[model samples]
Target: MSEDGVSAGGGKMRRRDLLTLIGTVAGSAVMYRAMSAMALAGESGFTGPIKLEGDPKGASVLILGAGMAGMCAAYELRKAGYKVQILEYNDRPGGRNWSLYGGDTYTELGGFTQKVEFDKGLYLNPGPWRLPYHHQAILHYCKVLNVALEPFVQVNYAAYVHSTKAFGGKPKRYREVHADFNGYVAELLAKSTQQGRLDQAVTREDQEILLEAMREWGALDKNYEYRKGLLASERRGYVSDPGGGTTSAPIPSDPMAMSDLLKSGLWGSISAGHIYEFQNTIFQPKGGMGMIGKAFGRELEGVIAYDSKVIDIHQDAKGVTATYVNAKTGGPPRKAQADYCICTIPASILGQIPMNVGDAMQSAIQALYYDASIKVGLQFKRRFWEQDESIYGGISFTDQPNGMIGYPATDYFSDGKGVLLGAYTFGPAAFEYAAMSPQERVAKTVEYGANVHPQYRDEFENGVAVAWHRVPWTLGCAAHWTEALRAEHYDNLVAMDGRIMLAGEHASRLPAWQEGALLSSLDAIRRLHQRVMTS
Candidate 1:
């Protein structure tokens, strides 16, 4: 619940009721306990900022891809007095952190909000997912931009059930998914303590031991499985992923394809998708996630370009030459010479642009897949979820990519009630949705939202879909992480040829997150700065 017990919708206060509701959640104990051991490393995630030595002369900075990474980089550089120019392929900023406007409350299409590092490390959606602590950089950016974030209270516990429909559809709720997770986790900790393992240095052997014990304890079932589903190649998230050769698999002939996940194929009943879960606590910007972009854009003042697109990049013995297309004009492309060019475009887009990466790194660049997203934000005139500010009931639908997501009218805003909801699609499903006509996508989003929240059916009766897929600049809502690139391309992703510098949420160790984008941006900028400084 929020500090004031106000629903995320700013509905009536319900602290007393929330306390009672939390008691009924059966499995939270096990989840929290199990995760305690695997929390974020205590080491500071960032070191001191790399200060420029007297800054560069004629350092007209060219920052490509105006998502969180690009925006943050531009803001940082501009503050430092560098002549910065942001060339965005999209018409607007805030790549994946997309949102909608028009009502008292804005509709957030991408980049869900959460409380990072609250009492513990950032809470993750183990299932039917959401989080309290996510979007660390976004929140920080919000503060810097003076955007107000509303603290939302829970109307009811975000619940997940393991009924027959859960396998593909939104798989249950937090209560069901995390059943006994907390207690089991606590039990594991107790046992480890007795064995003198608690608080010990985390050695490679220690990690393996913990992994085995965690599997037995059931942490791997949800956490590992969920992680492996999206990122199968490296098994970075799954306990079984690393120690290969079938920890438990009939194994698949085609490891890369999704067909191998069928019930009869290999790991019967559970695939990479089955292992994932969503946390119940998700927050919304007081207005909308879009306000975040709008706010950041404002903070940038005269820096962010509205119709600027980076078309080509060329490098030579002196420095780099960046060619840009004026998105608003049909005329020829405009070119600019810069001391450095920082690229934050998805690898898919990056691969299309001519850079100097040869045969060795070509395959890696080709494999980076941005989970295609087709967001259809439907604006309606009704309370919908009413006073519940659960942010789409903190819903988690594992079944369809076109699942519905929304928040209450009062939660979104008290007066002139309305629901801004949409669909999140990907892979083949994303392609299908991307092919959909604007009208068709709106119909589907409204239909789907009605199904997910039958209580809000009346709200979407004549709703309209404001789709990102149809927008030429926003090819799709932000980007997503997949198993393919993490395994095959982690090395090549960072393999610097000193040609194109890569940074964005996808390029970082953490995928599809604002913090990851910031870290990657800072990383590339620092590296390039250092290279120039030394050279």
Candidate 2:
């Protein structure tokens, strides 16, 4: 050995050097796993507003679809001095950013039509309802458009989490489940430290600090045990709330046993609000989510051509051409020509449209698959949830087919009728709900909701259901991208082919979100503008 404790072959091996050598020999998969273990994941790519400095010099752009992506493209391109026009299948704009209110009619793909009969001022947002605080693009547009926004209560202590297999099918408050889970987990870690099981992992001085933290965080007794007492009750709740009168006093509730708490599985739903995307300070448009779309429509008064169904897209060195027909009349096809094209149509529908592009783009277009989802809105005669159950707003989770019930964030303590998102299902449950007729879907939603809110049977007045798979315009809810699919096709899907570019949630890193659409549009325009300037 050398004087510095080095082997004959080399100096002493450092940890990072060994990792680098292992990564070089083992490949990217090993490197990725090592980075993940070290918590070195990258931050979001979205930085700020995308500035397209150069002008297009009077070049025109034909945008397909009037969804958030398409509309945002049209709005920005027009501002940038590019003559922009949009073709939309639906008479209205906003695409999936829609809301169904009283007297509204919707027809599905199978020719089944439903008329909403909710009371005035009540509505149901079928898609893209809640807006997270981190979705800066969406919030910026909403602010620019002067749309009024209100807080969306994502988590309520009084909200319920029900598992059919647990607690004899009784729904428990979110706070109780959350408090108990944290308390038990903290107690377990504290106990293990005291038993010297974590001696290797934690230093003796640090162990004392950790024990104190766990005791405070878990609301444990002086002995570091999670047990029935006032300490636990303060975090969970009191059996009888403290009263002001001399005859009444608060009674601490008994804490659930650690074994029973684990078996209940109610702890599973507690972390939903903690997710980065669903965290606190979520917001929604005041009247409905559709208000955002309506505001965009109002701003882009004559730019959108309603009821124009695009049949094909062909691009050449000169320009791009799109053929379309009137959706209402099925009239002869008309051609729209532009120097460049930005197609924001969902991949689910775009795959069917005959388009002339490279083989890579064609393959990418057909590779994406849209997700299936269903949302049902129920009109109630009264706000029984607030008056009787004391649940103001937030979601109540269940293991049943309905999946979850979302209380309305607006209209608190009003004497008028209220609307609630009775059922929201996805994946297999969404397909199951979509298979049923609109009326049947509504009836079943009431039935499943009654299991949680017994007042549903009496208070339910009317309902409307929107199964995204049956939506004629979109065919399905939003693009579903897997790691493998994204790795192979995502870049191809977004890259400009000839004079044509794609912009939508499917084309961006942020899928199924308004921010994704905005970012996708901004990125597409930036590239297209660059191409125009160079040419």
Candidate 3:
């Protein structure tokens, strides 16, 4: 806290510098915990239900943008005896918590309307699809709303890791890349230890144990060698799968050469599942992610004013008032006022709207930037991935600009049509695809996806592409924050200014996540309630 960035313990380290040191010495998992402790990041600080103990004494609240943050605020504030009303631009609830089903229509920024032609019961979640187990607030709401949940497969060995520069452009199974890479790494280490190369670092007894551990962990042969044999085949899979008949003898597939594997760069995709967020036990709603939004909308039956877009936000000595017009039938502007306001609009759109806040807040709003992203949902004629490739419900990574292909996690072994997340691109790739027409985007996904799954050429049915930057509601995917940006303006953006406060992912350390929005709303409501009680 000193001018020279010195800690009280005689250390010369600023907050950001200290965090960087921790991240360098320790891994991301440890640094994330340290960051969470220092309030630099969050790991879903949801410890059971929020306790809004005191009443608001009939104070009214006007909420803007019925996304996760706004809806969460209205639901909780109303329950705590505060009169709550919400103004949502879209007809439905769940801003980014949306799903596109058959007959669902979306009109992007440039007046391009896409009518989804998916089969009945098929859906594509254009926004969030998977919920990490740690996001307890959203999970709690799901449980409260009686929304059924299902498991989401994060890693499937039957899935693929593809690179155009690798293996003559042939896609490799995830298991092959994973097994071969781990096997080769363990073999090298084991040989080094056996030759006493690690004597300076590892003791004799420790080296022996390490060798044993590596042999087991990497499925190495007794000689600690990774080659075309039963050990490697067991890990990577057989050339011909073990069967039940007279021709049941499985053929061991040859392991890729270590140099070839390294050159392929497919090993990079294998470690993605080991990341903290993408780890096991992820879940999704039984129907779609939008089910949560639909549930929220139904619960707040009469409270939300749908299709009402706020044109301007103004606060006075008494309360906050929002000027608005009907989104669909903009005849004339209307006004909605309340004792306090919690605005959950995305910064991308909010910056363009008229809002009278302090210069700090205004500057923060304009300073924040939203990242570009795009997702293409393609409906295929049959369950070819499951039937032909034995890939059930996981993602197949590709080095192509389209990013990855995600198979549907639900309805296994079904005879009906299925949808595939053919392309999920970000950054420059997203902008490139966004430049194209929706149909062109869909076609590009099919073209790129065919390299991984050739069935796309024959089984393609219909498709819909959602470019986040073009989407009218959000304009971009989520808030993109750098360390410097967060330091300068994050507090100004989140702090309650007079009778108005901002609540969304942009207001929390956990940006681009629904949990951040919910947490921001909870924090805002708690502070607002305290202010009301004290006043």
Tell me how candidate 1 scores on lDDT.
0.51
For residues 87-113, what per-residue lDDT tens digits would candidate 3 score against the true structure?
999999999999999999988988888
Q: What TM-score would every model get versus the actual structure? A: 0.62, 0.91, 0.91
Q: For model 2, how does the per-residue alpha-carbon lDDT over 1-535 read when each residue is reduced to its tens digit?
A: 2222212122354434544554565597767766763452223434565576777889999999888889888888898899999999999999999999999999998899999998889999999899988787888889989999999999998999998888888888888898899999999999998898988998765565566668878998877888888888888988988888794788989777778879987888888998868987899999999999999999998999999999999988789999999998998999999999999989999999999999898899899888989999999999999989889999999988998999999989989999999988899999999999999999999999998999998999999999999999887888989999999998899998989999999898889998889888888888888888898
For candidate 1, the per-residue lDDT at 353 reads 73
Q: Candidate 2, clashing residue pairs?
A: none
The lowest-lDDT stretch of 10 consecutive residues in candidate 2 is: 1-10
**Model 3 lDDT on a 0 to 1 scale:** 0.89
Which 10 successive residues of model 1 have the least lDDT summed? 119-128
lDDT of each: 0.51, 0.87, 0.89
Badly placed stretches (over 4 Å) of model 1 are 1-54, 103-135, 152-283, 358-362, 387-393, 396-401, 408-415, 420-422, 425-428, 452-457, 464-484
lDDT of 1 by residue, 25-72 (tens): 335776775576235422213343545555655465777777778887
Error of 2 at 26 (Å): 37
The TM-score between candidate 1 and the true structure equals 0.62
